[model samples]
Target: MKKFRKIGVAAVGVLTLTALVSGCGTANTTNSTPSSSAPVPTGNAGTTGKLEIFSWWTGVASSKALKALIHVFNEKYPHVQVINEAVAGGAGSNAHAVLASRMTNNNPPGTFQVHAGNGSLYSWVQAGDLDSLNNLYQSQGWLNKYPKSLLNLITFNGNIYAVPVDMQRANVLWYNPSIFKKYNLTPPTTFSQFFQDAKVLKAHGITPLALANHGNWETTLLFSDVLLGTVGYTDYNKLLHGQMSWNSPGVVQAANTFTKMMQYTNSDASALHWQQADQLVANGQAAMNVMGDWAQGYFKTTLNLTPGKDFGWAPTPGTQGVFSVVSDVFALPSKLSASQKAVALNFLKVLGSAEGQKVFNPLKGTFSPRLDANPSDYDAYSQAAMKSYQKDQLTLCIGQGAVNPGFTTAFENAMAIFVTNHNTKQFIQSIENAAQTNPLS
Candidate 1:
C-alpha cells in the first residue's frame, strides 16, 4: 500500500467492469521473445539463481499462499532457489518502507509485493524503477484474462508494471451467523438497518461492531466504504479521483455516517489489530466486522471455520453492488542483472499464469484476477464475491492502493485524526486541506 499508478477520471471509465468468468484454458508461452541483452529462458533449461521474493505475507494464511505459489514456481524451475523475504506488518507498512530503502540504495529485491492500481506501482513507474511486463503478459496469454479496469490500474504509458495475483473486495461485512440467528437478526443491507441491528446487539451486551485501527488504515478503509455507501458509486469515484471536491455535501454526510457507525464499534478498537478485531466476531463477542475478504482466509484456514455456516457475508451496509477492490501485485526492478532479471521475470510469468492464480487465490481468501478462473475452485462466500465483483461497480480502496502516495498519506493522516475526534466539520476541513496540499493526482 505504498503508492502505485493513478486511476483518475479517465482510468475510472472501465471500472464498471464485466465479469471475468471465462473458460479455464491453458496458458501458452509460445510468443515469448526475450531481449538479446537480457536473455530469458523460455524453458527451465539452465535456470539456477537466487530469487528473493519480497512481501508482507508473514500471516498464517498469506504465508501459506506464498509458499504454495513458490512451490509451483519451484516445480517448473527446480534449480532456482527462492528466498522468502517476508516482513511482518499490516498493510505493508513496514515492508514497503524497507523496500523503499532497499530500492533507493540500488539493492532492489528480485521482485516485491505491491498493491496494484493507483498505488505504489505508479510511483515506481514514474521513477523508472520498474520494468514493464507487457511482453510477459502477451507470452503468458494473459492480455485478455483480467478486467480492463484492473489492467488499467497497473498500466502506465501503455506499459504494465505489475502482475496482480488476486483481487480482494474491501467492502465486505463479515458477521457471525450463529449470533445473528440467536438474536433473530438478518444481515443488514443498509446503514439504517445496520444501526438497528447494532442497537439490538448492543442491548444484549454484544460488541455490535469490531474495529481495529492499530495502524490507522482500518478506520480509513471503513470511512472509504462509508463514503461509497453514502455517495453511491458514481460520486464515490468522482470524490476519490479529485473530480469532486472533498468539501462536498456527500463527503460531509459520509463522514457523519461513519461517525455514527463508530459508536457501535468496540471501545478497545485502537489497541487491537485486524485479526484481533475479527476474532471478536469469531468468538461471538462481536456481532459484525467490516473488513476485506482476506478475513475469509483467517476464518476458514486459521480458525477452521466454514464460510456461510460459521460466518456470513454481505456488502458493507448501503454498499451493495459496489466492489471496493484491493489487489496484491508483484513487480520486477528495472536494475536487476540480466540473469536475475530472467529469473525474476520467470517468477512473474508464474505469478501471472492461470495456474498460479488458481492455486494462490483460494488459499489467500481472494479470487483470481483472471477471467478464466473457475468458480468451482472457490468456496461459497468466494463464489458469491466473484459474482459480485463481476457485476458490481468496482471502486478502489483509498487506504489500500488507489491514489498517489502524497495524497494517500495526507488522506490517511486526516483519517487518523478524524477517527479520534469524530468531528465532522474538522474532518472535512482536514481532508479539503489535504486534497489542496497534496493535489490528488
Candidate 2:
C-alpha cells in the first residue's frame, strides 16, 4: 500500500503548496491519505510522467464523460500520465473529508474539485492556500467566456481561484414522453398547474416526481427552486443573506409548498439514490424527476433515451423566470515551477475551448459555463436548457450553488425531517438557523 502523511511548513508567512504523491499505477483508487514519507512530487508532466488528479466523479456516465475529457487532455499532452482518483460513496463524502483534512493540514491535491462560490472560496484564498491566476484569466479572458454570474462567484475578495469544469444546471424537469402521453398531461407552466397535473398523475396511480431523499442534494435542489417559485430570486438572496428570516412569509410559504409536492413522490423514495430515482423516471414507473442537467447523462447512457424523441426537459416555472445553476471548478495551489503553472493554465484554457465545450459538456450531460459557447452541439435536454437559460435571465441557484455546503447539509436534514414529520414551520426555521449559525466564507 502507498503510505500517506501531512506536511506543515516551518515558515509561517510563505505560501505553502499542498503535496500529492506519485507512482500509483493506472488502477489507483482514492486513497485520501496525504503521505509524509515522500517528497511532494513535481515535474514537466507532458514531457515526463502522469498528472494525478482527484475528483468526485465515480458515477458510470459521469466517469465516462470525465474519461473523455482526459482523453482530450492526453491528445495534446501524450507523455502526461493522468491518474484518476475518482472515489465513490457518501454523496461526495470521501472527497470532502480528504480535502477538508488536506486543507486543514496544509496538504491539497495538485488538482482537486471544489465548487466556485463566494461563501466557499474566500477563506482559502485569504489563508494563502490558493494560487492567483489573474494573468491567466486576463490572457484567456475568462471574464468574457464564463458567465458573469459564475465568474463573479469564483472571484474571492479579488482573485480567481478555480478553473470551472462545467455548469451544473438545476430546476430541470426530466419527464417520460410516453408517460406524459399516457396520462394526457402536458409539462406544467406554473406551480398551480404543476400541482393539478400531479393530481392527474396520482389519480391514475403514478408517482409524479421520482426522487431519492437519502442524499440531501436532491432535496436541496428542489428546496432552492421552490424558493424561486414562491418568492423570486431577489427575495431569496435577501433571505439567504440574513436580511430576512425564514419566518418571513416567503420562506414559510416555500416550505409549505414543498410539503405539498412531497405527497406526489414515490413512496420508496427515501430508500433510493439519485441514480435510482433517475431510473424510475427512465423506466416510466415515475412520471418526472427534478435533478441537475447531469441527470441527462444517466438517461442517455442507462435508459438509452434520446431527448425530445423519447423524453423531454424543461425548467420548473417561477413567477420571475431564471436559471438556477451550479458549477464545478478546479483551484491550483501556489509555488509551482513556471512550466507546471503554464501547463495548468493551458489545461484550463482548453477546458474553456469551444471544442472542449462541445466534447465535454455533452458527454458529461452538463452545460458549459461559457456564455458564448455553442449549445447546439449538446443533447436535446441541454439544448432546451440552454434555450430556457438564455431567455429566462439567469439567477444564482442558492440552494445548490450559493449556499455554503455546511449550511446545505443543515437544510437537507431539515427537509428530511420536514418531509417525514410534516413540520413545515420547523423547516423554515432550520434554514434561518443555518444562515445565522453556520460558517460562511
Candidate 3:
C-alpha cells in the first residue's frame, strides 16, 4: 500500500502538475461518523464570529448544496455566522474577478472557493495570498482520508494550501435516453460512431449535439475532449505540459475533429449558457451534450429528472476508462484576523469532514474527494463516476486546472475564434504563438 501510494503521488504530480481542479448536497447519517457531531475542530470553545464563504456556486443545484452544508455547520456551531458571498457567471470567472479585486484591496474573504489544482490554487500561493493548511489537515485526519495524488495537487513547497470538497468528471457525454431509444442509437464510443449517429439525427431534423460557449470556456472544454479523444491520454498530457508541440499532428487532427463536431451543434450555441444547452438535451431538442458531471446535478435536482431513465451518460467519444478530474477546493486567506481565521478554520473542518461531504455531494451532483465517503450516499451517476475515479486512468481537465493560465488564456482565445471562423490553420497558428510566450511547463 505504501509503495502504491508513492507511485500514485508521483504520477499524479507529473500529470496534474501541482494544483487540484473543481463541484455538491445534504445530510444522510447512515453508518459513518458524522463530523457535525464532533466538536468544532479549531478556534476557542465559544468561537463566535462571521465567516464569509465565497465561491461561484450560485447556480440552482450548487447553491442548494451549499445551503445544506451551511445548515449542518450551524447545527454544530450555532454561534458562528456564515455569510454566503457567492458571485454568479463565467463558471467561476465572474466570481474570481470579484475575488481578485477584494484580495487586492486587502478585503479578502474568510475562506474562498478555488480549483484544487495548481493553475488557480498554486498561483494564489505564489502571490502569497493563502495560508498553509497543514495543521488543519493534521487536526482533521485528512492526510490519509483524501487520495495522496489529490493532496499532491494542493500541496506546494510541502505545505497543503486547500481542502478539496468534491471531484467532478469533465469529459462526460450526457444525452436524452428517450432520444437515443427513439432513434435506436447507442451512445458513441468512437468518433466515427458519433458522426454516424449525428448524421442520422440531423437527417431526422434533430440537432445532434448541444453546445454552449457563453462563458468562452465551454468551447475550450469541448476542444479539450476532442483533443483527448483524438490524441489519447499520453499525448494529451504531453501537449498540456508543453512537452508536445501545439502544432503536432494530434493537435491538428483534434482541431479538425472539433470543427467537424461543430457542424452538428445547434446554430444558437454561442448565445446559450451551459445549462441552456443542457436543457436542450433534457427537452429532447438536442440529442447529446458534452459537459462535466455538474450537469448531472442540474438534471437531477433542478430538472427533476431520474438518472438512467430520463438521461444517460457515457465517456466522451474515445475517452472511456479515463477520468478527467475537475475538483473544487476551499482555502484560507493569509490576511484574516485571528477571530476570522478561527471561524474560517472551523468551517474548513466541516467542509472536509465525511458528514459534510455526504450532505453536500449528493445534492451538488459530485463525488467526495475523501476515500471514505459512502457510495450509497450518491445517485447512480455519481456511483459510476466514483468507481471510475478509483479504477480508471486520471487526467487533468483542460481549462479547469490542467495547465498554466497563460496557455489556458491563449487556448480559449483560439477556440473562440475557431468557433466563429472554423479557420483550423489560424487556430493552430494562434495556439502555437501563445505556446511560444506561455510555455505550458
TM of each candidate vs. truth: 0.90, 0.84, 0.90
Instruction: Please report, in order, the local distance difference test score of every candidate based on alpha carbons.
Output: 0.81, 0.66, 0.81
lDDT of 3: 0.81
Q: Could you give candidate 1's per-residue lDDT for residues 19-127 as a string of tens digits?
A: 1111111111122222222234566533789999999999889999999999999998899999999999857888989999999999999999988766677778777
Which consecutive 10 residues in model 2 have the weakest lDDT in total?
A: 19-28
Error of 2 at 38 (Å): 24
Each prediction's Cα RMSD?
Answer: 6.5, 10.8, 7.3
Instruction: Give the residue spans of candidate 3 off by over 4 A.
Output: 1-46
Candidate 1 regions with alpha-carbon error over 4 angstroms: 1-40, 43-46
lDDT of 3 by residue, 132-181 (tens): 78767666666667766567667665567788889999999999999999
Worst 10 residues of 3 by lDDT: 21-30
TM for candidate 3 is 0.90
Clashes of each: 8, 6, 15
